[model samples]
Target: MSNDQPLKGQIIIFTGTPKSEDVFELVEQLGGTPISLPLIQVSEWIEPTDEQRLMTCPTYDWLIFTSQSAVESFGLKMKRFGVSPDAITSQIAAIGTRTAAALTKIGLTVQFIPTVFSADVFVQEFKPTENETRRLLFLRGSIAGVTIREELPFDVDEWTVYSTEKAVHNIESLKNLVQTEKSSTLLFASPSAVNVFSEEIAPFTGWDTYKIGAIGHVTEQALIEKGAHVDVIPSTYTLKDLVLELIK
Candidate 1:
């Protein structure tokens, strides 16, 4: 019933970028060895001319960051532009807590955040006030399928801040892992991982014996659509809850 209880001798595989270091540390602290295997790689949008313009812009209305990757990508570019990050004086809005933390790490504070961190809610927060229709700059990803522009309450400037690329697993590496079968228990935290993992394990079948743990409803739906017979799903939407369910 408690996550603090020992969970040794049980192996689990983490599927996502290194953004989940906090959760991984918790797993290790709780006697579980966390294996890192990123299903998708978050890449920064590389554009010489476009980035130059974004960096040289004067103070804008709002600077919205949708993902942690966008924050990182924009931060790197800002550093290159000789801006101490303090130069960008737009009221920042982070879509989620993680992205908010990422912004803080680079000396930025989020002015607004919603209860639901979806793109729909994110767009709705961009309505122009009575003062003036402030210009908005949205930092997103290259393959960002989720768009906040369509439902935007106010017309604002926007562009790709970073990009999401499906990571193609190394054949020999995957084969070796499958041959030894080290990752018997796979964890699907997001739907994006489910899509990428399906591709990762496509050529290496015989994974029906492995147990799958879906994190939330969205990931559960992705698992079901991918033909995975999910064996575990925690009621709460957190990694600690999922680890507790496994040990229980």
Candidate 2:
């Protein structure tokens, strides 16, 4: 290991979707052996009623996305329908820098992103004042909480474009990995990851012996609710911040 490889020889497991390979790469760059065990899976919504809603959607003052999944799902659907973002006159908003990046990657411009990385913070920053209701469209996952919808001043026209569920792995394989990589650092990016780990992975013997890291307040709450001790939690909610916390 080199002088800069502070995490040399560490085995860090990322518990998120397959799109989280970037986190794994960050771990590798820090000289850690990254392990992938996706704790969540995303699928297309069964009845795309939201697509229809968007198709005939009236002019809105703002369109907001809280997650990258929302951006990818909505952008793909727009492509399929031959719809152009230029057709919509509404301003776009995102909850975090990553979400904003996802929108920019697909040729959409973001007008707002909260400095803090949560829906509540986003609402606090942009919530309309009394008697200043704005027409808004929100693209989100089915499992998302209603904090954004409830906190905003106006009623948001929502489109559930995707659904998120816990990903399942072979029990025996996970058991073996737990046993073999007993010292590995486990990372959770969302409440769903913590829930899935509690349901599927924590049953294995000595599960609590592993080091654990969480990305944000919500994920840390889920970890605590599951009786898991989070050894590391970033002050900021981003995955890169979590990685830096782990290195510390």
lDDT of each: 0.70, 0.79
lDDT of 1: 0.70
lDDT of 1 by residue, 1-248 (tens): 24464656455676766575777776677676777676778877788676566764445677878778888988888777667766777788887778898999988878887655656666666555745446677777776554665567666666776777766663345435545765457777778878876766645764476777876776788889888888888876455567667766
As a whole number from 0 to 100, the lDDT of residue 87 in candidate 2 is 66
Worst 10 residues of 1 by lDDT: 170-179
Report the C-alpha displacement of residue 75, candidate 1, in angstroms.
0.7
Residue 52 accuracy (lDDT) in model 1: 68
Regions of model 1 farther than 4 Å from truth: 1-6, 56-59, 121-133, 169-183, 206-208, 214-217, 229-248
CA RMSD per model (angstroms): 3.5, 2.2
Over the stretch 130-177, how does candidate 2's per-residue lDDT look in tens digits?
Answer: 543567888889889898889887788787888998677644555567
What are the clashing pairs of model 1? 140-161, 141-162, 142-162, 142-163
Candidate topping TM-score: 2
